[model samples]
Target: MQGPHSPAPPVDVQPASWRDLSSIRELEKLCFGRDAWPWIDTLAALTFPQTVRLKAVSDEFVVGFIFGDQRRLKRTGWIASIGVHPDYRRRGIGRTLLVACEDLLGMPRVRLSLRGSNDAALRLYQQAGYVRIDTWKRYYRDGEDAIIMEKVR
Candidate 1:
């Protein structure tokens, strides 16, 4: 029998589609709380062209998600959102999703923004070679400052 100390199950990253809307929404809520995108925005990410959406699944459960937008004008892929279910964090799911999304985006550079107070996310981005590029004050609904980060190839 598995116990609390048991090893976590391995997850597979896969292309996400509209069918994953519900589970993705659930994961986002768990990861971002009040910052979670609305259902309509989630749907748009799944259905929109020039967007790369991916999910991490373990034992048939969606545990993480990422969305990236390909901007031809900028030759940069914008990582719009990325979240890992709380229970599945620290197992490398976020990094895997990020690498996969970046690969699929096929851009010369990538960018993303996160709440300035999200130190965990800041560390993750920094570890993945993202550098601070800019900051948008009161960028969130709750007036949290946004730190823009970018990775250039």
Candidate 2:
């Protein structure tokens, strides 16, 4: 008899370095399309000091990634960006990267901003204990308002 299918292997989240710039750039393009960060921004995220960068690897592939900026004076950590390849979405990769980055940031509060139209990301952040704190008008190049969210520990 055929046995029930086994669960897929859990994705591994690890620190991301400059060596991951190319892969992270590709993932950003795939996940954010025109809103994807430019190569320079992606490079900075991977190489900047006081930033927490993490990648979710599945089967040796960079399936998802996140970048968090730590501001010690303000005691706030800002999640600058997070994305998962379309094929890898909904498998907890985003959440995993998010949690890993948050842990590494070790801030009293963490914040992020996303397009108002991005319902999926909104739900994910909300489910992970974030709450809407503010909104920026015309935040994107295309004029989509950015919904800012915050999570305080």
TM-score of every candidate relative to the true structure: 0.96, 0.94
Which candidate leads the pack in TM-score? 1
- Error at 95, model 1, angstroms: 0.6
Give the per-residue lDDT digits (tens) of candidate 2, residues 89-129: 88888888888888999999999999999999999999999
Compared with the true structure, model 1 gives a TM-score of 0.96
lDDT of 2: 0.91
Tens digits of per-residue lDDT for model 1, 63-123: 9999999999989999999999888888899999999999999999999999998999999
Instruction: Provide the lDDT at 9 for model 1.
Output: 78
lDDT of 2 at 31: 89
lDDT of 1 at 6: 88
Clashing pairs in 1: none
What is candidate 2's CA lDDT for residue 1?
A: 31
lDDT of each: 0.94, 0.91
Highest lDDT, which number?
Answer: 1
